[model samples]
Target: MIHSALEFLTQELNSFIKLKVGDPITNRVVLSSVTNEQGIAIPDQSLGLSLINIEEERTSKDQQNRFINAVGKVEKRNPDIQLNLYVLITANFQNRLPNNSSDDYVEGLKQLSYAVAFFQSKSVFTQENSPSLAGFDGDLKKIFVELYSYSFEQLYNFWSVVGAKYLPSVLYKVRTIRVQENAIQQSGDPIEKIYLESRHKP
Candidate 1:
C-alpha cells in the first residue's frame, strides 16, 4: 500500500511538472533520498521526492477490537493501521556556469515554486481529481496533501541529519493511508435464542 501510494504521488507530480515546464527539462522526477551513499549530489535539475517521516493516525484506533460478522459470529482481527506520510520534494539544479552561482540557485528555487503551486492547486487526490490514483488496485481511496511547515532551526537540523546541503525544497504531508488484513484469528458461534421460565406453587 505504501509503495503504491508513493508511486501514485510521484507519477502525478511528474506529469504535472512535465505539463508545466515543457520538454526542456529532460530529467525525470525520482523517489529517492536527497543524498547518496558517499554524500554526493543527487541528479541535476531533477525533483527528488523523499519520505522523511511516518506517523500512525491515533484517531483510527477505535477499530482495534474484535468485530462481529453479518451472521452474528464473533471474529477476532488485527487493528487497521492508518498512516500519514511526510514527503520532501527537493529541486536539485546544477550550477553549470563556472563563476556565477546565482543562476543555479534561481533555477532550483523556480522549480520548487512550481512544485508548491502544483500541490496548492490540487490538494486532494481522488477518483474525480486523479484518475491514476483512483484506478489503483490498492486501498488508496483518497489522499489529502498539505504543505508542512517547519521552524528554521528544525529545517536546518533536518538537512544536517540528511547529510546534504540545503536545496530548494518543500515539505508536504500526505494523510490517511490505511492498511488492513482481513484474516480472522478466531471465531465463535452466534447466539440463537434465550429461554425463560416462570413457575408458581399452589
Candidate 2:
C-alpha cells in the first residue's frame, strides 16, 4: 500500500462495515477521505474523535483558538492523513453573558458555522452555549426544572426561538478531494467494488 493509502480506502471499509458494523446513523464515512494504515483502512475517528481541548466552562474566541491549536497538533502527528475534529461548546455558557440583541445571537451562530467550514476536518459543536433569545422558558420563577429538566434543553429551545424570530443564512459548506494519482493503479480502485450481471436466481 502507498504511504497515502488511507486516501482511498472507503470501498474496503464500506464492505467491512456492512459485514461487521452495520450502517452508521449519525455520521457518514467521507468517501474520498482515509487514514494511514498499511494494507487495511480505518474508519473516520468520529466514534473516537470527541469533544477535546474543552476549557473549564469558557466560550470565548480564545477558548475556540485553544481547540484549533489542538487540531494542529494532531495534524503534525499524522501528516499522511488529516485528522477530523469537532469542537463542542454550549451556547450561553453559564459564565459569559452574550450581548443582548437578536442580531448578536444570529451573528454568533453564523460565526460558529463559518468557523466550522474554515476548520475543515475540524468541526465545532455547540449544544450548551446557545443564547436564550426568547427569555428563560417562562419567567425564571415558575416550578422550573420540570418542563426543561436540563439547562441544555433550555439552551436548545432558546436558540430555536431565536431562529424562529430571525433565521440566519448559515449555509454549510462541504469539500471534495481526489487523488492526483493512485499508487495502486494496477490494483484497481483503493476501494473495492461489487460485481453485477443481467439477472440470476436459484
Q: Highest lDDT, which number?
A: 1
lDDT, each prediction: 0.81, 0.26
Per-residue lDDT tens digits for candidate 2, residues 87-176, read 222121111245544225453453334333333432321123222211332111111000112355644664464342222222122111
Candidate 1 per-residue lDDT over residues 54-169, each given as its tens digit: 99989756566578899888898898888999999988776865776633878778777878888889998886667788666446888999999999999999999988788878
List of clashing residue pairs for candidate 2: 6-34, 87-123, 87-124, 87-125, 90-128, 90-129, 91-128, 91-129, 91-130, 92-129
Clashes of each: 0, 10
